[model samples]
Target chain A: MNARARLLVFALGALLLGGAYMAALSQLAPLGRGASAYADILNRVCVRERHITDVVTAVNFDYRGFDTLGEEFIMFTAVMGAVLLLRRGKDEVQAPQEDELTSRRGRRRSDAVALAGVVFTAVLLLFGSYVITHGQLTPGGGFQGGVIASTALWLVYLSGSYKVMRQVGPKPLVEAAEALGAAGYALVGLIGLFQGAAFLQNTLPPGSIGSPFSGGTVPLIDIAVGLEVSGGFVLLLLTFMEEVLEIRLH
Target chain B: MLNIFCYSIAAWVLLIGLYGVVTSRNLIHLVLCLSVMETSTYVLLTLIGYRVGGTAPVFADIPVGTKAVDPVVQALMLTDVVVEATVMALLLALAVQAHKRTGSLDPHDLRALQG
Candidate 1:
């Protein structure tokens, strides 16, 4: 359709949607109530049963473990798909002439900027680890922490070069870590099965609430997810950067 | 009411995102519009779970009787955010490949399969 016609259709759709939403909002009950039916049960039993002060983490890693498992796999599959789609083709060849072009365009880095990047990356790595490990007790969790940690790798790339990144961690090792992380999540779930509980059942002891070592298997799952996410993201970045650099892949 | 205001803002965001997506010409712009749509949904979900006087759900220093905001929606939103990131990554990757093969980023210009 033409631009005018498309705009008219979109405007009409928006009007209808907005009207429906306002009508629904008017009919809804007032907010600021106590626990919902679902939240009520969670509040009543989650702390005592799982010994986790963070109900969100408990719900994510324990109460709704299966769903979290599926979410992790979704990420794993997406990363794999990206790798497969972005793979270097057999017909493509890298020439040394591109290096000259890149070098000519490359700008000199300042010493201060490089130093700041290194310092910030170290701090980010530390903070990310703290976030992942403290997930059971705090607001941040595996996914958030993992993404933060992955930024450190990006910082290294930004401050230096692709060659520096490769020296920091080889492709095979990073890829292996990603696979291991995904597999480790499943392995943790299988442990519950072997212990006579259903899949992903938190059979380990739910230690004291509000402690670092509490939450039974929740922390373990968080660590596994953290590993998987960090590895997957770093690998994704590495692959994309390689493509940009026209690096050969065999 | 404050709740109504929050909901209306979210609705506006959603509508704006929809409008952007419908009118977007470049593939990159379309992906960004999609992200805006996702953000609207996140805002709606978080606002729906908000309690006027509720504290954070953590029990670290709060009294047992203190009311807390809904944790279920927060957990769901967390998952949604991660999914959004990965989805955007894959979409951008596809856009890159399309640019490589078609030599164009505009949807109207990509007619390789029209025949």
Candidate 2:
């Protein structure tokens, strides 16, 4: 169908869908008044039970850890698919990747900008590590910190070059780290199984509340997730970058 | 009345995203429209989990018995976000393949699937 006709059709269907959606919305509790009894109990108990100051992390990495395992694999598989799809075919050459703009224009990069980028890269790396480690105590965790840390790779690329980014995050090393991260999570859960408890059960010392090591395996899982997520994203960035640079060679 | 306004905003954003998806010509634009649609869920989920006088569910600095919003939905929101990102990446990869094979990003140009 043509664009105009398709939009017209969409409008008619949307009206009905919107009506049904609004009806469903009306049934949900009002904003700021949702009395979720289960969450209330969970929030109240996570501190005493799991020593997790961040109740959300407790839910993600503890109470609902099994689901999180499945979630992690979904990401791993999807990223793997992306890598497969974006890989260079047999016909593609093994030439070095260079910035077409800089090479063609022959312009020099600014020293000040390069220095600032490097500084920012270091700062981001530090902050990301802090976030990942303090997941059980603070609002940030693996998912958030991992993405932030992965940004460091691009910062290095911007300041120096793509080759430097690749050097900073070597492909085989990153891929192995991603695999290890994925495996680490499962292995961490196996600690419980080996102890005759359920899989992913929190069996370690809960430690004193409010401390960094208080949440036992929760923080451990967060570190593994941090590794996997950052490694996966860096791999994605590398794949796309390679594709872009290779295409420019033509 | 105020409650209706917040939920209405979420609903409207969802509709807009859906509209964008149907009208999108390019595959990348369609992928972005999907992201926009996923954003509406974040809004709706946060709204559903909010409490009138409650704070974040953390107890790091605060004492026990303090009122807090639902952490369950927030945890689920993280799941939602991860799923959305991975799906978007997969879709973009598909878009790259489609462009390479068909030499066109426009969905309308390629109506029939040969493979």
Candidate 3:
């Protein structure tokens, strides 16, 4: 359909949807007055039973861990599919790939931006790792931290350190990390099952509250998720860069 | 009655995003419109779970038994964001591949599937 026709249809649909949404809003508890018994229970029991300071982390990695597991694999499969879609076809010439390498040599490198990127990469990595490891303690968790860490991987390229970036996170290494992350999560749950407890149970020692060792399997699961997300995104960035570079050269 | 503001904002965002998607000629823009719609969902979820005087669900600093907004929806939002990112990346990749095959980024021009 033409653009105008499509807009007309959309306007009609929007009106209907808006009306339905307004009708539904009344059902929602007023702002900041919503009751969540489940949240209340988790908030109360998490620290005492799971030794987790962050109830969100407890729910994600413990109570509803299976959901996170599914989410992680969704990410893994999406990355894999993206890479495949972006892959150089069999008949595609390898000439443009090498052309980009030589072209980079003649390109102007900015010392100021390079310095800034270097500083940013270091700080982002430190903060990201802190977020990753401190999931049980803080509101941040593996997914949040992993994405932050992945931006650090991007900064390595941004700072005119493309060669170093490639050296640090090659496809094979990133693939392995991503795979291990996906597998490790499943294994954590399996360990619970093998122990005759419920799958994804808080199987590990609920380490002493407020300590790094606390939250039993939570920290372990968080680290694995961190690896998975970071690796997956790095792989994604690398694949897109390669494609874009070839497009630019050709 | 004033509480409707947050939900109204969410609804407005959703409608705007849908309008963008309907009018979008470029695949990348359409994908972004979808992300905008997802953003509306996140807003709605947070608004639904908001509690008066609630702190964050973490008890690391606050004393125990402190009231906090719902953690469940926040957890859902986290996954929602990650999935959206990866899915957006995948969609963009597909767009790239489509362009490579058809030499066109305009959705209208690419409507006919070619083997």
The per-prediction CA RMSD against the true structure, in angstroms, equals 2.5, 1.9, 1.9
Per-residue error at B32 for model 1, in Å?
0.6
The lDDT of each candidate is 0.81, 0.86, 0.86
- lDDT of candidate 3 vs native? 0.86
DockQ of each: 0.64, 0.82, 0.85
The stretch of ten residues in a row with the least summed lDDT in candidate 1 chain B is B58-67
When only chain A is evaluated, what TM-score does every model earn? 0.89, 0.93, 0.92
Residue lDDT tens for model 3, A157-211: 8775556677767889988988998888888888788878988887887888889
Among residues 3 or more apart in sequence or in different chains, the pairs in candidate 3 whose N, CA or C atoms overlap within 3 Å are A32-B51, A32-B52
Error of 1 at A105 (Å): 4.4
Which residue runs of candidate 1 sit more than 4 Å off their true CA positions? A94-105, A247-250, B112-115
What is chain B's TM-score across the candidates, in the order shown?
0.91, 0.96, 0.96
DockQ ranking, best first: 3, 2, 1
lDDT for model 1 comes to 0.81
Task: Report the TM-score for the A-chain of model 3.
Answer: 0.92
